[model samples]
Target: MSAGDDGLVPDLGRGALTDRVRATVLGRRTPRAWFLALGLATLVSLLFLLGVVYVLSVGVGAFGLNIPVAWGFPIINTIWWIGIAHAGTLISAVLWLTRQDWRASISRSAEAMAMFAIVLAGSYPLLHLGRPWLAYYLLPYPNLMDLWPQWRSPLVWDFFAIASYLLFTASFLYLSLLPDLASLRDGARRRFQQLFYGVLALGWRNSARHWARYEQAHRVLAVIAAPIVVSVTGTISLDLAVSIVPGFHFTIFPPYFVAGALYSGFATVAIIAIILRGLFGFRDLITRAHLNRLGIMMLCFVLVVDYAYLQEIFTAFYTGEAFYRGVYFDRWTGPYAPYYWGMILCNVVLAQGLWFRRLRESVPGLLSLAVIADIGMWLERFQIVITSTHKDYMPSAWDTVRPTAWDWLTYAGSIGVFFVLLLLFIRLMPSVSMHDMRALLHRRREGGHG
Candidate 1:
């Protein structure tokens, strides 16, 4: 193998690679760790369900919302989850289109992460709707009374953005899965397993014609997904950017949010890669080099985020607008100042560690940084949502909005929901892209790296 190929994959035959990945799903004995993790995730998901029921029975008033700070955990979580979803598309679609061989092993898991994250993202808006049952009102379906959605409302925009992104993500994931599902169907000894995979495979036979069509479809989707990736987050950012709110009305928000989203997204992919590697003993497939690449990407985006932070502050003072200047002042010295500083610490200070090669390649280092990056991104969203509106233009209306227990409960529960869905996804499907890995191996062999 060439030196450049080091830490991509281990020396293994095609059959060995296929067997290792397939065994994660098809093996008879479930791992004890998997059981434990699933149990914990399920418990948390139940908690989330309980929170949802309580909110529905009572109201969104169960949260820490006030007249000024009407947007609370719901909006914060929606933006955070949506941001996390970006990495999956970036990894699976952008990397594939670019022919980055390192993406082969991690792309499937990344896509799954994106899929679940977007689902969680989309759910928050419905929860935030005091009457979730009325969520359909956000849609533009014709009615007998001739009522229609307010096209100008951010809620309607979110509805379309999230729904479109979710559909695109699902199609991308299912399209990518067809070949692997066919492999699972062919390899399954049990009739039930065969039937399950066969139905999902959509009758994929791995013929040359099938491959040709698959390539064409996948490339087309990839081309479409790249723009969707930027547009979705930018649209979400416009929810704040289009507003008259001092801190929220920055022109830089679209690009700022995009960078922050990709930053957090790559960090999440890294965390998932590390967990998958540790749990499945995929040291050879998801190697240190992959972590290094992830860290580099994270570093790249966080740098952009840091620059945005500076630009935001500069734009505030440059305009010489008291409201904008006060927003920056409040962010630095207000009640939520701690969160703003913590975001700076995590996204700016600690993120600089990625510039060091040793730290980026170290499992513990990369994992710690990834977790920190996600937390930092959350803090960024938290401060942006809460601090912006908590003390608006009017001193008379300025009030503090502290999160109620229900707020924490709902937020934590959402995290649980995401994990539960992701765990089940990995257990049922191939965590790694089998066909992509095979193609990688084939290319490596042709290049004398096998």
Candidate 2:
């Protein structure tokens, strides 16, 4: 973990570190690159807003939902987003608990990604609900009507899981921002700037007692967040695992889902880190060392996911369950065969390149792998969700799951939502956690890893 010749963060003192972080937010003029990116994101977001309006006006008929394949792109997008969100908590909370100093460089962006992705994921539940206005009925508050939510349902589980995760992620992001906000307020050049960040800082005096409380709270939150990351995905998998459908009924789902989640989540974090490193000039902060570590993590999860794939196939063959066996065969040989093989190539075959130190450290190599893995993860979700439901136990009821224009539009637009939120986050505040980076610098000065 030593910095060696390639440190994760630039060896800067307190003043330089503060200036480096503060300049990202408080710069008098916006960069042309930022303006262009924001314009594109805003345009896509506007289209997304239009798509939502269309969906609301036209109803669920706008999507492609047939008899056997009721769930379409919405479910796929929901699960994909959820998987992406999982990496944030794992990187932020789990790494902090394990004392990985490299995390300090990327945790803020990762956590912000998770929080934004959660909102995107959460929207699917409402959007997919035919009567979206009646979504409040999912909540189990006392009412005059005797009707209540079915506690045993997976949908209900999803509601609580997503809700709980949102609360935890929001609190974690806000609490961690307090110290930075206080610094920004103190260094404000204008009265408006001081007032703006001052209110957001929540009046932190940074006393010894306050620092002690912050540390205690952060530790507890990290502990709480670790389980939430594991449990939320497990609960989401229950939606499929509990089903009696052939591919859906497998016992390997929970672990597989979690592995898949981390797999794609790490890829997404890498994508964001790499893009922002260039766009925001964080080459020193988000260094190649950090990218290499991320690549290694992605490779580790690739092995886990590959093992789970083998297990799913092996279990089917061992159990001699014709339904499960057929599902596995159909996955690689059926109409979705291309997707399955593409997933294998992208996730398993191509990902093996990371075993080499050179490739892991290469910018284009890491970026290519990250993008390919993200596509593969989406395909993984598509195969798992669609293949299972499109052809169930009854052969007569089998049908193809095709997405309409609206389905494609809405899904693409959700990506817009993620970018818009992320771009705004980077623009408005110190995207990098200044306090944590300072700590990292301190650690390195003390002859430790950062």
Candidate 3:
């Protein structure tokens, strides 16, 4: 069997795969679509600047941080972006460990997405703090005022959790890019391009010793990253679980949050993979088989999420706690009923399309559903935060909350930043893992394309 037989990388060989990926970064002229998307993202990203300026000058009062619902769009967007980041790291680390060949085609881009998404996610926590300059207070620093982060606070937990994930993600992304950077350094036609890539590559000779050491370092990094998939979000879940509120207090939050994060993260990876595959003419590399496998992975998570939902409802009733029962009731029929139902349909009901071979194989169908699932995930976060916080144990604390224009602007701006980072990544590096693809080619020659 050849590479093309199993519908992976068709007509694969070292020279062809290297040339195809290198051209994306080293080419003189970039695609028009890249320019248009970057321009739009840049424009929208300015909204972040405007919102920050207003908040800094006018204080956090410029936005809609009301009494009952203090955590609004900013918190919601933060959680959503963090979940997206997890998907990339999870895919790259787990798939590589399990020896999945399809991961070779998408792992580079996925890791890049994780890094950029986490960077964007980091911005919200500070921005949500009205006095953004005082953000360093979250850190455990020795000070004359004797102020330190409360050891038991979930906010403090979140700070360390995000910091840890970001560090690992950056290391993982850099390790994966070393070989490709070396490729760019050698293949560059311009003097500046050679210098740039050379500095990034750190003088790689591609010797046997280099390959052996690189593989060892890569494995160690993967080992360190594997546990983060469970730990980071589990820490985030603590932010809600420790609270005395009805909907927020639940034992299932840790696993539920992790399952939802991976579910949404995989959908995001699919959407980006589909776009990049189409734009760069990487049809053979990111084949239907890859998409099929991704769909099945998402289906497994969908069943897990459904079970989580059932557990939440059952536990609420079985425990017979009015606060928990009332919160769930409001979640189903409260002011945000549309968001609740929309989340269910998009994530649970509509995702049923993945069960069919024809729909899963259809690029357009999966793309549309992936996008919907992404939105559904965001809604899930929104419902979880708002329903629990909006109406507390006391009736007097109940208040309706809505995001103001500034809130929306900040949210939109974070999205802009995410896309700008993603677009730059697409333009500056090989979106596919080259060395991994070479291994795939070798395996295919030995009749192991399956």
Candidates in order have lDDT scores of 0.91, 0.88, 0.86
Choose 1 or 3, whichever is better by TM-score: 1
Which of the predicted structures, 1 or 2, would earn the higher lDDT when compared with the native? Answer: 1
Q: Please write out the lDDT profile of model 2 over residues 254-289, one tens digit for every residue.
A: 989999999899999999898788778998888889
lDDT of 3 by residue, 1-450 (tens): 544666766576788889889999999878888899899999999998899888889877777778788888778888888888887987888778888777889899889989988888888888888787888898888999988789889989999999999999999999889988999898998999999999999998888899889989989887777889888888988998998888889999999998888888888889888978877888888988888877887888877887998999999899998888888899999998999999999888998888987877889988987888789889999998888899888889899887789988988887888889899998898898887788778787766642
The local distance difference test score of model 2 is 0.88
How many clashes in each structure? Answer: 0, 0, 0
In terms of TM-score, the best-performing candidate is 1
List the pairs of residues colliding in candidate 1. Answer: none
Lowest summed lDDT across 10 adjacent residues in model 2 is found at 1-10
Which digits, one per residue and each the tens of the lDDT, describe model 1 over residues 1-450? 552357786677778999999999998876788889889989988878998999999999999998899998999999999999999999999998898889999999999999999999998889998998988887788899799888888767878999999999999999999999999998999999999999999899999999999999999999998999899999999999888888999999989999999999999999989989887888989989999999999999999999999899999999999988998889999888999999999999999999999999999999999999999999999999998898778989999988999989888998889889888998899999999898888778656431
Superposition error at 1 for model 3 (Å): 5.9
Over 4 Å off in model 2, which ranges? Answer: 1-6, 447-450
